[model samples]
Target: MVSTAPFEEQAFGRYRLLERLGEGGMAEVFRAKSFGVEGFEKIVAIKRILPRLARYRDFVAMFVREAKVLVRLSHANVVQVFDLGRVEGKGDEPPAYFMAMEYIAGLDLATMLTRCQQVGVRPPPGLATYVAAEVAKGLDHAHRRRGEGGQPMGLVHRDVSPQNILLSWEGEVKVTDFGIAKARDSFEVNSEDSRVKLLRGKYAYMSPEQARGRDVGQDTDLYSLGVVLYEILSGANPFRAPQPLETMRRVCQADAPPLERLVPGLDPGLVAVVRQAMAPLPSGRFVDAAAMHEALLPHLSARHGRFGPSDLADFLRRLSEQLATNRVPVSEKTPIAAPSHLTHDVDHDRTDVDLPDRDDEMAQASRLLVLGRDLLLQGDLPRAGDALGRVLVMAERHGASAQASQARMYLGYLDALAGLPGGEALLRDGLAEAAAQGHRAGARQGRFLLGRLLENIGLPRAALVEYEACRRLAITDDDPLLATECDEALARLA
Candidate 1:
């Protein structure tokens, strides 16, 4: 699929992008604040597929179907999906899609663990069990979610790691990032292609079957949760190794030291629970996520009397006060009530321009960068120059290096299309900047554009080098369409 072009609106369906939280191989996650009538402002996390991969109909359709199935999942322990939407392609541009989800104000388990490591304090044993118990409840809910017809959805959260376990400032645990989640019904759609059953996740958190690329079920989520529990209590991932292949081998063979042995004096009961949940065979593990939660509840009570969200909240509060640090990280601050001076204005930039918080501005800059590119594609050079130039200024002001690189790249392409000098140098510099920042997709795009330029200038060998590099990247990203394009380019050169 030859996917291209930009969004018509600056804000994606009226949810103003606040910050680019993170990006994965498949999608980019953004923190957005939605505005509605009568002072209604709601924070949501938006996960959108990368524009480069937007036209992969089979993959996008699979994600859309899973999103529809995910909307049915409503549990206190699971993060909610407020909306799922798609924008139709206009002319050469392929459709863009997104899913808006409940945003957690605090941090993930991984971040919390890092903070604890920096402060030299492992979480209390009871709290560890409590966190896992909460996650188990969420998993149970996801696994047993039913369709509108009352039949089982059989959802399996393929990626259940410490990073996916969100802890609110109020100490509530919510399972998040059902991005790679698979519904049982999804298998029948593309069962002919074995890649349909493939699961991608951190090797240390994967179940034996999952690590071996076999069929996964609800039990797979429980196994990953067990890894989380083990990490929390023992302060180490059981199968973690310096090398990826070694790590996979360890995970598949269950070749790790016993948790109790690794952390001396760890409650024997807790040890038993982790070991059983992480059993090599699916049958050896707990019957379901609910059973694991039940097993963990007693440990939570026995170790710390009546442990709950309040207790977790208190611990986080006290830790924040006690821990001394210099670097800014996600704050665990939770307000009891909205301030009296809060305004109903939807214009976030006006309120935050003077403040040190630049997420809103950065989001605005990102939007402009896209708009500039869209205008360039639409042959509106003057407007594209204005928008791209403004984005460069905003990117520099906020120190958003990646955005700055992209802005320069588009501006260079714009200049070339309009018969200007120094375009090639700017494109090369932008590609170099992107490479330094590890933006593989952006760098590959720059290479592809550079290849076109070189080919136009009667330099087939140089163009071949650039297209070859892009082919490798396409293969690495698992973008078959792009790989095929690169193959066609190479064939022409040959």
Candidate 2:
């Protein structure tokens, strides 16, 4: 809330601390600018360890670990750390350690949730799914990261909550405060050499094992994320009790009420995804974050096609504008803050971003369909099936009927070519559906595939009729390439 940083506009280890953003028990964050030669300056958030704790060996080790791990991570959904250094404090003061990080000009998920609760509305499911899925994408990247010698890094955030998730006004979802996972050989993240019971993450978000102070794995983070999602969608954390111990006990023993029981008419698909992520046993959850991401993305596939409601970016922008209009008087005490669920993180906390609206996911499906079609035509059955199968599932999920039919048409052709059963039936039914839907290209391809199947069955006259139909459709569509394929087939039959 300070109008200006006390050490305003002056250099401190290649950076000028402009203003404080937030502070917690261990460190303070400042909105600073990094100055370079030739008039270069870039705004960065500098996380400076509190002078009192800078000399503590274990705390310093933890701080160094946070910086090291953050520097290694590069993701759109994860905050970036660029530099770590030390600077002289005021005369007779201890040296200050700091880590410079990416400055986000938007609010944290905690703030968003609070505001939404104030307004008595939940974030749209599209936005919720988008957040969960994007965060999962970042987690998946970190989960798969390998060390220099190709060993699995085994990095886990150990904290995934609304506070740790930042949504920029431009629609970026960034997770903050990584590097919490202990080294690969260590079984517990929060455990030190003697296995002290110092708290590491919020109890409401803790996985069952983590709450019990036992070994945790990557699935632990997924469980925490599921808790966040549950709270966002249901407006309550089922495990949160007045007492921390009670909360931990509930996390270990109580089953979460089904999403439908809490919020009726929720997408059953998404409900299942969230429930699986929060399963008490890690084995019951998704095998990895990648699987969770795949299951969640289908929910967002239909977002781009919807109208009337603004997206998450717009919601944040409007919220920012409203908060600014009501800003109360303040001064000198603000510190750079972390997203609550994951502390020691940084955020922008202001400004607006107008990200371009995402195009409907069907566009992606369309491209995959075309690629699958080309691969099928080239006799690459395995690759073609892989691509076509994905496109079919995606198209079907998003209600892209034409695309789904075309996917079916191509897959049926692949199946027949590979001598699989039910090929002819699939091709004929898909062709009928595509033709009824007025999918000209799908109909054309379906005719050619059926003609080939008929030829393989020695039905020369039926195959001739199929080839002739395909040739007419291709010519009418001015698809010379497809017409050429039909001609080659007809010539072979004759």
lDDT of 1 at 10: 49
Report the Cα lDDT for residue 293, model 1. 90
> Highest lDDT, which number?
1
Model 2: per-residue Cα lDDT at residue 333: 11
- Candidate 1 Cα outliers beyond 4 Å, as residue runs: 1-10, 88-93, 179-199, 302-304, 322-494
lDDT of 1 by residue, 1-494 (tens): 22244333347777888777777656778898889999899989998877766766777788788788778788999999989987676799887788999998888899887666443345767778889999999888888878789999778888888888998889999998674544322333335655553324688898889888899888988888888898887666777654567578778987656776546667788899999989989999999988999999888664225667876776676556545432322122111111112222223222112322477456546545645654554556776786678668777878888888888888887777677898878988999999999987678777776776677678999999999998899899875645765776788889
TM value for model 2: 0.60
> Can you give the TM-score per candidate against the true fold?
0.60, 0.60
The lDDT for every candidate, in the order shown, is 0.73, 0.73
Candidate 2, position 468, lDDT: 99
